[model samples]
Target chain A: MTLYSFIFYILAAVILLSTGWAITRRNLVHAVIYLVISFFGSAMLFYLMGAPLLAALEVIIYAGAIMILFLFIIMMLRVEGIEERLFPLKQWLPAMGLGFISFQVCIFLLISAGSEEPLKAAMAEPAIFGHFLFRQHWLSIEIVSMLLLIALIGVLHLGMEKKRKESGE
Target chain B: MIVPYSHVIFLAGILFLMGMFCTVTRRNLMMMVLGLEIMLNAAAIAFIGAALRHGHMDGHAMVIFIIAVAAAEVSIGLALIVCIYRKTGTIDAGCIEGDVCEL
Candidate 1:
């Protein structure tokens, strides 16, 4: 009814439609591009929700970095121009079933979680967000750092093994 | 109230379901990974929405960690996909289960 509500609905429609199209698209590259647009929609939704810091992060990390990584991998695999590989109705059965069930569950959760009233949007600015991360959630930060380190090492090992196998052959 | 908090949850849920649909139906391994990234973003949206509703900074912090973890995951998963392509010569996930092609 209000402007905020109108904008929220528009963004949600953008996200759902783009992502639905992305999933159904047969071209991997095209799908990734569509997904990036959906990510942008979600990022704006984050901004509207008063988490500008999170919104920026969503754009930077999700739409920017992660999408580029997908593109790079798609190129590496050379699965280009494989146009319109539609999943048969049989193949779509499971995704549809699961998606429907999960959506119902989520609605139920929202209803049970109370607060049918709309939220008074509150912004968690970057300064306070950073303070909370360092002061209140310092342990999580350290663990995440360690996890990133491990992932880096694991990826390098995998790449190196591929070279070793090629040379041995 | 401009928009109901529940509206945000519903939106996120829809996005998450879309991601799941992509993951289950995609034949390409890379596409599946992209689906996973979408699902993670949906979670991030929900987290931020909850933070807004609660007047806390925890949601932003959670999103930061989610972003970091998603980056790490995508990097490692893509590297594995490269190895898969090198060994198998195809990115089609069902190529292995076809039983005609020797692993």
Candidate 2:
């Protein structure tokens, strides 16, 4: 196999296995860690796709920011480190079976469809990406900013009032 | 091309289904959120693969938007999870009782 195909296969395997492991873990923190690995793998795969800007954003935003958010929430909830929660065979087995079966089905479907050959890869440089993002997608950017602001306000509204009462007692 | 476009799509499908399995089987609220994040990652992979396949900047643009949406989602979701823990004293979705959390 070509080096490119080899790298692609390895990254894809890394993502799949890490996510599977993450889901199977009983400890929430452990799961989050695995999720981070999976996200990092996904970011690398994004790099392989030639969208370097998107890949960097995936690493920064998803692997870095999002995971830190998860860890903070877990810490605040005081469920850090190991957990005593059990994943019984009843639940774990069924989920594993479902995941495996779906994986098989997807492979089968992909092979059956007989894919067209992929085109020559193009590098999507950040300079061009930035211009297109701001120029053609300005409206989406504005809307997303508005969404983030509303979410921030909602979170503050949800959190501050409750804390005030709890501390007052 | 390094790998066939269809193979990338297949990989995305596996990740999405694995996420689905996690969401369906897990009783913990945080696990469900993690599952959702995995599902979003799968979507991003597919988008990036499509961009590579077509040599179009539009797919890259879409992936960027997806990242923005995912960030917003995770922020709001984690906030909600923290709120739930504050009010209910637990994050177990299955154990929620008496209007504390609805399934």
Candidate 3:
């Protein structure tokens, strides 16, 4: 009813619509573009959640860097013209059933959780959250950075092997 | 007054459902990857919502870590897709199964 809720509903709608488009679209590039829209929508949701830092990081990292990498890989692979049949509907029936049931459960849980008073009580000092992250969880932070380093090394190794194979042929 | 946190969870659920639809119906490898990204984003939104509801920033920090993981996943997955394409000349999930063909 308020401005924040209105914005939240609008962004949610966009995210849902774009996600549907991303899956159903036949063109690979179009799907990726839809994914970008979905990413931006999620980032906006993050901002609404009182996390401006995460919102920016979502846009910059996921929407910008990661998607660019995906786009580049798609272009390099050049699989646009390949013909493929749609997956059979029977194959997805079980998954669809499970997804529907889980979705309902999730909605129920969220609505019930929202109605409780703990959330209001939980809204104390936000600064304490930062203190916990930078002080108590510093080790996890370093581990994350190390993981990124390993990923980078793996990517470089893959790229070099690819180049070597190409040159050999 | 305003329940912005509730809206966050609602949106996240919708997004998660959409991602599930994508993952279930799509046969294209790239589309599947896109769906996976959507699902990840949905989870991130949920984390952010919980963080806001709790008046904590730790959720945001965890979201940063999630983004890094997603980036690394995209890099490695796309690289593998390229390799597969070079060998098979196609990115359809159907064809790549059963036999390992030469590039």
Candidate 4:
């Protein structure tokens, strides 16, 4: 056991625990808070991976920007304080069973993959990552941007339709 | 007692499983979305763990892309939830089921 492993375990524990809390909590706001904790843990994990840039971006983009938006919508829509019904066991039981089985399968596959030679060796220069992203995956970058654009348009359409209905149009 | 990269992967797997559990079990729409975010973040952690294990930057790059997608997903999802709230007046999963806005 090394110091790095110790730190990794602690962070991983925080992430997993927060994820469980985020899922099980009945209160929507509490779930969101747990999600923020989970995000923080992931960010720390990213930092441990030797990608400080990715770690910062994870915190800033996911935890800071995206989650704030989610919270804002929850607040503006007044959904946070509302009481929700208890979980419906009939529907969830089957889903839970299936999810567990699939998850186990995935874990098995990942473990098998890990036993193979690891991917590329650790590079001394991180900037090579940036170069590869730009040179090889530029199309993926563009596609993601396009997807965001479409999502934005979808949101606007939904908003407009809601307003139209409200105005009795 | 330090753990190793493999332990990190195991921990991330547990977290991912927990997040999936929330996604499956939660009835509140907002909570479901929160669960989805957690699940996605768990995947991100796994990516980072692999990157550290291999000492490569590709995994980090992948994490960046995943974060970008998560942001886009949340923004769009929140917007839809807002619309769902306006029409149904509730964020419960059952309420939105038969409502005109099927999200």
Query: Best candidate, TM-score-wise?
Result: 1
Q: Candidate 4 lDDT, tens digit per residue, B1-103?
A: 2334555566667666776666666667777777677777777777876776666656777777787788778777777778777777887776676755343
lDDT, candidates in the order shown: 0.82, 0.83, 0.74, 0.71
Residue range with the least summed lDDT across 10 consecutive positions in model 1 chain B: B94-103
RMSD of 2: 3.4
| Over 4 Å off, model 4 | A80-126, B1-5, B98-103
lDDT of 3 by residue, A1-169 (tens): 6676667678878888887777777788788888889889878766665666667778899889988887887777776765545556677777778878887887787777666542232332346556767897798888888888888898788768868988999
TM-score of chain B of 4: 0.88
lDDT of 4 at B10: 61
Q: Which DockQ-derived CAPRI band holds candidate 2?
A: medium
Model 4 Cα shift for residue A73 (angstroms): 1.4
Comparing 1 and 2 on TM-score, the stronger one:
1
Residues A29-147 of candidate 1: C-alpha lDDT, one tens digit per residue: 88889988999998898888888877887888889988998887777678854333556777677767776788789889777866677777667768877877799989999999999
TM-score of chain B of each: 0.92, 0.92, 0.87, 0.88
Best by lDDT: 2
TM-score-based ranking: 1, 2, 3, 4
Q: What is the DockQ of candidate 1?
A: 0.67
**lDDT at A159, model 2:** 75
Tens-digit lDDT track of model 4 for A1-169: 4666667668867877777776767666777788788888878766665667777787888878877887777668766544545556678677778878877876776676564442222332456777878887889889888988988888788779977787896
Query: Which of 1 and 4 is the better model by TM-score?
Result: 1
Assess the local accuracy of residue A7 in candidate 4 as a C-alpha lDDT between 0 and 100: 75
